[model samples]
Target: MTPHQAEQVSFDNTELDKFAAYRSDGATPDAPDILDLSNNELMLPPLPAVAESLHRSGLRVNLYPDPAARFLKANLARHFGAEPAETVVGPGSGGVLQQLLLVLAGRGDEVLYAWPGFDAYPLLVAVTGATGVPVPLTATGEHDLPELLGRVTSRTRAVILCSPHNPTGRRIPRDTLREFLAALPPRVAAIVDQAYMEFDEEEDPHDLGLIREYPNVVLLRTFSKAYGLAGLRVGYAFASAEIALRARKTVIPFSVTHSGEQAAVTSLAQGEELARRLAHVRRLRADLHADLGAQGLTPIPSSANFVWLPLGGESDRFAEAALRAGVLVRSYSGDGVRISVGTEEAHRRVLIAAKEFLSV
Candidate 1:
């Protein structure tokens, strides 16, 4: 008799295969000295207060963290002027988003997001057993809200909007976003991913009136980008109490480590430090933009901590040149490249690479 063949595994294998793991072209060992402008990480070290908190929390690593992340959640709630029940904390914004997707969508459900947006959006949506519907961004790297609104179907359970959109760094204007949210069907949830909101030119980053105005809107934020806690991996979301409760239930217990919680809470209290850091990053971004423009590369105006070069078919070439110049920048193959604002030295290397590439 023939050896028994194992039965085929169940679930959507095709869908899983179609999705790719999130990729970031960060520095490699071969280029140990390379200036990494690939990942949009804060170029500066963690805040002094946050560092102190981390050191204190490090001593308690043996103990399990609060599963509910109560302290962090409470701080986040107070910061946003929302009740504790309205906030859900997770390992990072990506982790929080995953929980949200699990709670709001499932097999045969559709999740809509802009293309060339956050690299993780599609992957997370796929993991939830939901179909990921991507709407292409406009030529100027702005979300085509009309196209997005038009694509909505009855099966569309959630829409993910990235302000100061990843890669492109284009923000949807407040009025435009308000109109879009108002027009969206009340049954469909809207997730505004604001990981880079702090870097935006807005005076008040902690404002949460949008949630009150639109019950279906959920705001996602991360300490990784602005707070320089990428290593600790802390993020949170604010939404209606009902939605937050569901999302909170889906979070993996103790996913937000004790150190992360303590650090994030401490970081939240350092508003002046945060403002200074934001101002510095904005200055660097502006300088980088001017340098790129002077080199004849018209990078899109960015409110976030990175710049987008819509190289179209030549994106890989520019990335390659940057790498050769000992600078690591993110490339989207045929679409564009995103270079994070880094130190003056890193920006100098990027500028040299840009000049060389443009000349060729």
Candidate 2:
């Protein structure tokens, strides 16, 4: 075969194109109009102070960002009580995940993660030429530990755990995570992706205590969620100093820009105010859950900023109606619809749209 033919053949089987294929079709305008709920981004930008800082810090456009992303890493460490040396920041949580996968797993290896979890997990595994072992959640929509434990093999190099899992919004309890970590072979690393931890009111959040005990455990977080910095694209991971240092080395230098780093640090510094804003989102999420239930739509109990509506037969239809209503909600044909909790007015608009769909 000619070189061109081989290149064409290689592109055809590229697994990174999973969701990449779905990106072409943009959301319809008539949809829910509630794009505000996307990954915890507020319709409004940060407060004036943050905005002004961005404005004045102008045109460092000529210079590259700090290679280590020191300021953002320091702020995240201070905010989360992690050791500064144990933290590393990336362009976003997705970037951090990609870095982790690249560093830990390679071709012929196995990666264990929960199913109906993050859409990116399986795709990333496939791109790496690694086997993606997806253990489905239980009926209640919680990650099933026994089944996951059963899937582990000597080839399993790592496990990815997302608490307050995307799509489902069900968090893996701390004790459960500890148990899973303990059961895994010492050679295998467990990556805890806490993208929605800020929305969780759980008394004892997913334990970072394990990091001190297990050199293989890594905690991943993102400013994209509660910090309302999704557009700025900053995320981080915490692990033992050794693992964190290794992960940092794999990161492309200056992957995070100047604005992204500053925004993340500013967001962390606005802690109390940010917490209040997150609480509002939680309240709205609760209200949306109740409103949808009243509309005869069964929604999964959400601990995140978004709620899941299990539209067994009409998932697509309902999503279509939402789009028609000028609101944008995520729809998975075989799964359910994940709606972000927007402002109160926006939430009411979505409820109206959802009600109309249910009536039909």
- Which candidate gets the maximum TM-score versus the true structure? 1
Candidate with top lDDT is 1
State the lDDT of candidate 2 residue by residue for 1-360, as single tens digits.
Answer: 988877753464344554464234645444343344434456556756567656655568689889888988887787778888888788788888888888888878999988777777887777677778888877777888788888889899998888888878898887777888888888998998889888989933335687888899988888787877777788899888988877888788888988888877776667678768877788788888998888777899978878987775677787777766666777767777788878776677677778889787
Candidate-wise lDDT, in order? 0.90, 0.78
Q: Which stretches of candidate 2 lie over 4 Å from their true place?
A: 1-40, 203-207
Q: Using Cα atoms with residue i matched to residue i, what is each candidate's TM-score against the true structure?
A: 0.96, 0.90
**Cα-lDDT of candidate 2:** 0.78
TM-score of 1: 0.96
Write down the TM-score for model 2.
Answer: 0.90
Please give, for residues 202-235, the per-residue lDDT of candidate 1 as tens digits. 6257688899999999999899999998999899
